[model samples]
Target: MISATLGIEIERGVRKLLDEAGTSWPSELKVLVDRPAHPDHGEYSTNVSMLLAKTLRKSPMEIANKLKSELEHAKIAEGIFSKIEAVAPGFLNFAIDWNVWLNRHREYSAYQGETEKGKVVIEHTSINPNKSAHIGHLRNSCIGDTLARLLSRAGREVEIHNYIDDLGNQLADTVVGILHTKTEGEHVRFGDFCWDTYAKVNKVYKGSPELQEERTRVLHELEEGTSSTAWIGRLTAEKIVREQLHEMKAFGIGYDVLVWESRIVAEGLWEAAFEHLQATGAFYKVEEGKLAGCWVLRHGGEGSGEAEGTPSPDPEAHQADKVLVRSNGILTYTAKDIAYHLWKFGLLSQDFTYMPFADGVWSTDSQGQAMPFGRGETVINVIDYRQEYPQAMVKLALEALGYKEQAARLLHVSYGVVSLSPETAESLGVDTSAGKGSYAMSGRQGVGIKVAELLQVMEESIESKRSRQEGLSSREIAAAAIRYYLLKYHLQTEVVFDLRQATEVSGNSGVYLLYAYARAGSVLEKAGAGQKGSGKALMEPPVPSFDGGALEPPERQLLKQIAYWTETMDAAVRQLAPNLICSYAFELSLLFNNFYGACPILKGPDDRVELRVWLTWKFRETLGKALDVLGLPAPDRM
Candidate 1:
């Protein structure tokens, strides 16, 4: 907010200078105001003069001096800045008048201005309904859920969809294993039972071509939607989905809708999409050779140099065109995805029937009521980086059918895979004697950490070390620790999970932030400033007058950080990056801690106590909002 005010005044001053010289302002130039690294430079500084040197044909220092002189006498700048300085080498610095700012500045509120239009559909946690969810799946869920919260905070109508691929090969393999093989152990959940069965079936298929053919047969029956095998597949998928949702709820993740792949096929959405693509002349059939009888989409003269009517010389070569349908008349995963996206953007002629799945949640079914679920102006899919090719193909299909605007609005938020650190792998009973620094997770090999087991282990660890005086339960702390740990890294960086580092009570962790919030609450309660039955002090409108004349250095720094909350939130929403919020919250906590150690709130001098108390209240309010956006619980005491 401060930056916006400074940028306007600087631009007006620069324009006045340009008007006198008959100079037209450059349309592409933007004014950027930032906090300087040293306190001696003033509160905020701008280099607009340096940016205008080439256009004005003058030295930067001369322009800076003239602009500074023009700004000093401006009516709008009279009450805002105590001083405006022009330093060496073309830089303009401004020291704020704290008395005017504290009395007039608006408190932080979620932006509900011109940018908050249209509905956003975020599809995430689209795990295949075959086995239990692993640690990597947790990362995808955490990222997606936090994004939904952040967008909603910015006043966007957001809907979340969890796509379930029940008709895929993974579920087919799991069904064949469950019906044909015999297991040896007792299981508590159906998903856990399928985990072992899936591994066993893959092992047997390595040597037997007969089992591979049977797997293909199962896939066809599952698509037909009338056979006994299809019935078993439906039962299997629904059971696993229930278990997955249960685990996700423990970590504060929920969905508004569950879109099953079978419903899309049964409703003929894929058939409509196929016809639409064929009419555009980009989708065709391979007449002969290795890709004979298969429907393919050419890559717009890119990739392997095989033409539409030509036969490939090498059967094992990477094909230039993507096959949407195989010779046996079955749709590929990419083909189904193309159809789903068309419905998401409301380009398809058909829609799904919805039924209540849980409290305030809906699911697509063959027989239910019609509802308004799709037709999102913007769509974001949170899949891993490995699916980049398939995601691109989906976009290409949209463009081929002349839905170019929807194609441009489609976003693929790709992230890296998760691995286990050496110490964590050893704790999970994996063989770390090989001395590898990181171990990748694999479901086929049964070498991964399950979501349910991880939560239980983390909760037990927190309980063992927590003091009785702490006002939060172990489960609450565990959720905060895990969610923050997964979101602290950059989206594209490979996460190597370590339990010890995530649960630390000091240094840049969720526990540290929680402790700082509780400490402020404790101070307010002791001074009788807290309202009855509330964790925070009474925050009335039009901030109360305080002793700004006696402000200490630490107090000034804390106030600056508190004032940047709205700017930080705007940047996070524009970039669609949650790590920026994590960084801001951590730095804010550190500044508050510094002020706590240096200045007293309850035991301060009589004239300064009111200012210090108001500062602490603002810090708590700002930090609490940030915690909500990041999907971390903020307890008053912990």
Candidate 2:
């Protein structure tokens, strides 16, 4: 992702200058290059000369003049940079030869067909196997799927993990409520039944302390593992989680590994984990205070309260620790997670007997058929941000246990939740006092819309649009539009869940982007196809020399945006945010729209036709790549 071509030249200039100055350094001296915020400030600017001014005891301007003079004498300076100019603030600005952009355009365009398998561990849609898939789950999967696609395209080995919370308080509640309610012959999906049972039980327990106590009692039984209640509880949870996974697959979400909480607990991983922590001098017993009888981990932190240069509350704070094993000798939730994290990094000498739940949920193969189960090399946990502390603690514990490298490898990829629609919130009588503000979805009392129902609405909207749209197959139009809308927006923002806007078949919706691709498809059909006819025949054209002579302002801008593909892929990988890619797609779409409106691809006859056709096909290919990164399908008809 070279931001500018002249940057490569400028780095060489700086390297030669540094060597000439007899300054020994480590690695390549990285001079930060950027496109200046103001167009008047030239295409690319660097502040390295200014940065060295203080050490050199010379004015930045004096240093800049020397580099400007030296860089002009460099071999690669020809055609890459038209002129080198210095600003009053000691910054160096370089004007680029637009021909260099044409070269970048061709370079990036080659990556379109590049196949990949380089490995990535993507953990997403880790919905607590307690209830149904809500809007928040949708957000997680959409972002995760898009990221997986981008990484795979950029050539990465991707392994998806869908973790289910198989043992917890919610599991107990659903088991108690659903088991009592279900009749002898109900053929309900576990998640669907859990959804109904959870909502009903939640509705009752919210106002009644007695009902709440009953739910807690069931949880204790599950924890204690003695009562028959525990048996039914675990089974009910397993079934429900299975149903949720099934629906997730229906909406194009799949995971290579399906990790469960119950199996780890059964294997005594937590017991072994507790011993590891104790041996590392990271744990001690809490003999006093409210935490009596608890085996707590030492906890302290840096703040104003701590002495200067000392971590306050210190890792030695209270001379006590966080309780790894709780008062009743029952393990806390944190303990289980610690064991799981250790196993993820292969630090734990423990293993789970991998069993197929056969819950009827499966991942896809290369041929669009079902491919079930895969072993993973890395693990990601997609949980709510509140768990960031717990996750951090897991990392800290790993480091304490001397798995410092493993600690560094863990990623807590958090995203804000999708909120309830305002009217839905009002209709459901949502409590504004939860302090989570709007990002709360209460599955109990039936507060949230199911993902299936939401998709159904989208599908119907697609059908309605298809019926009205002329000369297009219903299936093609419906799918293209739906997938595009799903991929169009940034996933980090808390979507307001506007049912109307989500279902609306036009304007920045996924369908609209698909329509744009479809429109490009129509143009290609009219011209007897663009890429296969010319791209294959063009013979890579000696680094694709373009005159910039025929490039309109719009064409230049489009080319400029097109050149950002490498950055988009790299940025998304580093940041772990698909929103970055989504933003790129939107920008690319807007650029293509303007280019299509202003410049005619086939207007000029003869040689111009092939070049413009090549450009048009390139645009389609680039646009198609953008959509592909988002896992949005590019249908020819739509």
| Candidate 2 CA-lDDT value | 0.64
C-alpha root-mean-square deviation, candidate 1: 3.1
lDDT by residue (tens digit), candidate 1, 1-638: 56666788889988987888789999877888887787767778999999889888999999999998888878444466777888879998887767777876553233433275899999999998999998799899999998899889988899999999988999999998998877669888899999988888888888877988999999999999899999999999999999999888887899999999998899999999988887765677776677888887665522334553343445433176688999889999988999999999999989999999875779999888999998999999999999998898898888878888999999998888899899988886788889998998877777788888787777887888777757788888887888888888889989988767766667888878888888887776666665645544444323556645456889888887777778788887877788888998999999999999999777856557777777787788788889999988877778
Weakest lDDT window of 10 consecutive positions for candidate 2: 363-372
- Candidate 2 clashes: the total is 13
For candidate 1, what is the TM-score?
Answer: 0.92
What does the lDDT read for residue 547 in candidate 2?
66
| Predicted candidate 2 versus true structure: per-residue lDDT over 491-520, tens digit per residue | 455566656767776656666676677676
lDDT of each: 0.83, 0.64
- The TM-scores of all predictions, comma-separated, are 0.92, 0.81
